[model samples]
Target: MNLSLCMIVKNEAATLHKCLSSVANVVDEMVILDTGSSDRTPEIAKSYGAKVHHFRWNNNFSTARNEALKYVKGNWVLVLDADETLTPEIVPQIYSVIQREEYLLINLLRQEVGAEQSPYSLVSRLFRRHPEIQFSRPYHALIDDSVATILAKEPKWQIGYLQGVAILHKGYQKSAIAQGNKYAKAQAAMEQFLAAHPYDAYVCSKLGALYVTTGKINEGIELLKRGVRTSEENYEILYELHYHLGIAYSRLQNPKQASLHYQAAIKLPIYPILKLGAYNNIGNLLKEAGDLKTARKAYEAALKIDDNFAAGHYNLGMTLKAMGLFTDAIACYQKAIKLNPRYAEAYQNLGVVQLKVGNHQASLIAFKNAIALHQEQNPEEAQRLRQGLQEMGLL
Candidate 1:
């Protein structure tokens, strides 16, 4: 049941400690392969008793990950990123699974937080140590290689997906500028790699996401649509492409097309975020179309999946307000504010509902609160609040 935790990192001092600490007691050995870090990442890994190995940056993730795999001597190896951590519930599951010899690879669900969705999905992170299990694909490296061909001959070899544990990915917290730099480097590498392998669907899909993040909406949409057309049966790439396409179409104010892509995204089995986000977006689009009853149903469906989602409550309130259901709208806004007190839009909408119901005094108070919250982040919204107050002669 011995286990080894392996990772490759660079300039990750800020999150390395948190990542390593989360699994320090769960594994028998920790191996960290650092790629020319200028920060104290190596020192921090050493402090956590991790066997640190230094490797020069080769602009290839597969090479680095394969090198890290060479240092793993345990029966089971768990690959993790410095920005990711094993949840407390997953540790017991890993130990239980490793005790049995039936599985060669165990894929756990990865939960990417701070995004607009459920965040949880499946990925292969844990594997039985075998000489044949090598990594391939330069940028977003994967373990499926010629090893799969060899393993297919072994009648006892089996790969199973585990639902007991999930890896929390926190890599998206970097500032926009910092993220832009990382994406730039990744884009360069991916472009060079694609020159030699132009039909790589995964790299094409990843490049599309990078373009979207960098504000190249048209290029992103084109690349994503191309990837979708080429990789029709590839659910992961199709789901991501459709999701990004939906976002791009929404930005272009083509809600009908956006709704179509969103519906396509939700049909994929692997898209948790797409599932919830599609419902929310469809709700908003329906509200904009003046379909209050359908919009309310969509919001309710989103709330049923995630009760604490403030956006769902806020949108539900807006839909109720559009139907002239003032009291119900106020209740929805109150719930939204309870979930997220700093939600200025909820306060503003609440004020609008109050004014419609002829509660000028309460409307003034809500507008004031909205203005106070909006002052620092959004001056235009603050001005709107002030205008509302002025129209009521309360300013």
Candidate 2:
């Protein structure tokens, strides 16, 4: 089956090349629809031998995505964003799935690069080229709603998901978020959709989560509670609803409520990789509540899901340190630092642990590394560390 890479972009020149290059071998053609770009995004798209088209910006992601889909001339369509790339490891799996006759759509697991809270997400980005399968919603647009309708009418069509990570997405990174007033744009787009779909669980999960992260706690809580009541057995939606609620309640200083929500999210029948956030958060709650043993178990569960999770390693190190297991704590902290070299907190904790174990030289080096990393990110903390070093006569 021929696969077409379909994308809607604007001013995405900085990341477009990488995105196109990642799928160059797997896709037969690239179709890019630019929605009013002021940058050289179209030029970059064309450089990759993509058929680039232009569309007016209407502040609706679904409309733009639908327009892009119209240009696909392949048996299958693989949708991606400018900052997202197909993982080379999953290319063969994607090819295998697309050749299957029963599949109407395939959901791909995406790893959110640089995200500490929720590192994985499921995206319904691969599908057969059918006229009836169009996207919906103004933001976070997807064809899932239409897929549901089609599957109901045509029982022969089946939807499936790849269990392993298929895409590496960098759009959620802090640098990307700061560039385009992205928070404002997402809020405006999602809020527009919410006006028409006030009770939509998808919208509730999305916009409510946004509101919670952006300081509108009460509004987000109200919306997410509504989502929990109205969601139609969508484990994905339910998981997100509870996950964001946990964050919201944690911010409100209600650890009991937060733990409950996080556990609820973890208990849902979702992929284990997707449950990392809830596991980490509940572990944090347990640690703060003086339940170090239970917290260690929670962190261990997260690490079992993805051993490379730096936060899990660092948190596990903390739990171990509190339990007076200095040797094990040092190993966990070192593992975390190895995974993320610039992890300032991990370095700081490693310094403290090294000092506890009487490794004076290593302790000083770790403290210096931590201070240097914190200099720009947290100057006040850096100054405090400097003072501690001076008092210890190690400066």
Highest-scoring model, TM-score: 2
What tens digits encode model 1's per-residue C-alpha lDDT throughout 186-284? Answer: 788877877787666667787877787778889888888878878757686677778778878877889999889978887787635436667788888
Off by over 4 Å in 1: 116-121, 144-158, 174-180, 271-274, 308-310, 325-395
RMSD of 2: 1.1
How does each model score on lDDT?
Answer: 0.82, 0.94
lDDT per residue as tens, model 2, 87-136: 89898899899989999999999999988589899999999999999999
Predictions: Cα RMSD each = 3.6, 1.1
Enumerate residue pairs that collide in model 1. Answer: none
Clashes of each: 0, 0
How big is the positional error of residue 324 in model 1, measured in Å on the Cα after superposition? 3.9
* TM-score of each predicted structure versus truth: 0.82, 0.98
Off by over 4 Å in 2: none
